[model samples]
Target: MPHDAKAAKAGTRPGGRSARVRTDVVTATLAELTEKGYDQLTVEAICHRAGVHKATVYRRWGGVDGLIADALALSADQPWPIPDTGNVDEDIQLLAREVYTTFTDPDLRTTPTALIGAALRSDLGAAALSAFFTARHQQAAEVVTRAVERGQLPADVDPVELVRAATAPLYHRLFITGEPLDERAAHRAAAAALLAARAGLFDAPAP
Candidate 1:
């Protein structure tokens, strides 16, 4: 029998045994998902890898879907490295370059790529994925915010929109068209986003 969904929504408690358990379980989940892919992932395998009792996982996370969601939720709360170059143009270019490096680098790509691919296979994971991107966008928007403060960008430009514009093409090529991404493409995307922002094309709509 499946565990209650309400139990899964309780979230991981910070500190002590609960925190350790959450860490172990999430680590195990990522390992299993990376090694076996989503279709082959199983609660029993996760339990064995985590070395935590099956009952504990079921009672806290409910099932595989809940585990996946919580994993993404945890990831979202973690700090992402936002660029800090004094020049807004360099910062934006670095932002796009970071994405390109992450997805295209052999050592860095496997786990995150597998995690996102698995997330696309389930509704619970999908919602978590949405939250994950939202959190990332908010964090990255700081680059644009600082640029505006320095008068490098128009005050009316939407920070999140500018950040999104800078990096969205790489994501489209990566997750959609499966096109090969190059350094030139990353630079081009950043340039186009900056040009549009300068032209006031990404100004926040009057509310």
Candidate 2:
């Protein structure tokens, strides 16, 4: 692929040729990151995979870390369809299934784990990880908040906490215990979190 110099030089949020280049870079980075662990991921490797010159990768992303951050941001930006099934139980199941699907996706699953591992080992990585999670949490919170407003949930639930509860177990299994991300485990965790929320674990204190 021919590298467009003007596109490479343009601002981060690009249009036209710049946007196409950005998309290509991100796609290439994701492929490299998935195939090779973080330690082995290189600018040269991304450039080779992306069919762009090393200078193009360097000019756009600066380095491997910058590239990974952009890839992660792109992954995070991918739509997470949240269902509002009118019944909280059903909605929670749908959310859990969605998460399970994501965790099992060959391409996506490794990216987050790699990013989180990097975050644990480096301050800069940690900041990037924090930003990623903050965006994810905010999105999840909005879904839960909408559920609460619609009376699909209790009146006083803290959507942020509820979202965390739903996801924490899966993270724990994936990161803490290094267990498999299987369907049974996902369903159990989702059910537990929804049950707890229904039981008022995330409810606001009465005045």
Candidate 3:
């Protein structure tokens, strides 16, 4: 594919030559990262897979870290499904269960799991990972916000905090301790986060 210098240089967002290039590059990045892992990943490989010149990748993304960061940024910008089951507990449980399922399911696990693990290996990737989680937590906090409005959770509850609490343990086990995750663990994480929120442990401090 011929690189549209103008479009690539213009750095357009979503729906143009630039977007197409981005999608192709990021997709290639993920595939490369998944197959080769971060340690063995190379810019030449990514560019070859993406069918773009090495100059384009370097100019736009700087290097491998930039590609990793941008890939995560793109993922964060994408829409995520936040559950709404008309019950706070169920919504929270569903959120935790979704995380568990995504990371553990064989067909679903390879790309995302590899992507996240790769993000942890470098500074730029780590920063992007933090921003990615921040975006996700803020988006998922809608569940707690709606629950509070429905009198299901404390009015002062910190929605992001509650959402983070519910999902942190699963991530910790998956990434930090390398322990096995199960359905019961998912349920427990959700329950514990909810219990803490109800007890005002996640309440926002007064200004």
Candidate 4:
């Protein structure tokens, strides 16, 4: 999960009973996603783990899809992964490494891949995946923003697309190609994205 500080500062961060309940539900939701996957996940099971009544969850969340969506938002609310170290190359490298680390972490490794699979199957899943990526793109775009401010990138660059281009190849290797990811692979992805950005490939189209 990638979270921006700006949003957290705006009061979306939960607290008190709401926080407690959200923590429990979200934790349970991830556990279920990691184990049972989207298709097999059930509200009853999540409630059992969260220790909240099923009706309580249903009334607020509507069902499993709502829980899944909020669970993603909860995770995205964490401190963003992209480092703002003032060097575009280094920042993209850091971003790649962070993506690699997340996809390889035992606790989180399965969830994204599973969600990708889910995204291919249902509208709920597509929406959740979209929201997740939207949050991540927002967070990642920061690195590019820093780069542009420092003149490392053209002012016309699309920050979000730049970040996405950097990470997409890494994800392809991790999830689609089943290839091993290492420092070399990570740097390669970053460099390719940098090259593309330098070529104005990531620039926004003229209005």
In candidate 4, clashing pairs total 1
Query: What is candidate 3's lDDT per residue for 60-107, written digit by digit as tens?
Result: 999999999999999999988999999999999999999999999999
What is the per-residue lDDT of model 4 for residues 127-203, given as tens digits with 9 covering 90 to 100? 87777878898888998988898999999999998888888888788657889877788788889989999999888
Query: Which candidate's TM-score is highest?
Result: 3
Candidate 3 C-alpha error for residue 96, in Å: 0.3
Q: How many steric overlaps are in each model, in order?
A: 0, 0, 0, 1
What clash pairs does model 2 have? none
The per-model lDDT (C-alpha) reads 0.91, 0.74, 0.94, 0.80
- Looking at candidate 4, the ten consecutive residues that score lowest on lDDT are 1-10
Per-model root-mean-square deviation over C-alphas: 7.0, 4.6, 4.0, 6.3
TM-score of 3: 0.92
Worst 10 residues of 3 by lDDT: 5-14
Regions of candidate 3 where Cα sits further than 4 Å from its true position? 1-14
List of clashing residue pairs for candidate 4:
2-76
Rank candidates by TM-score, best first.
3, 1, 4, 2
TM-score of each model, paired residue for residue: 0.90, 0.79, 0.92, 0.80
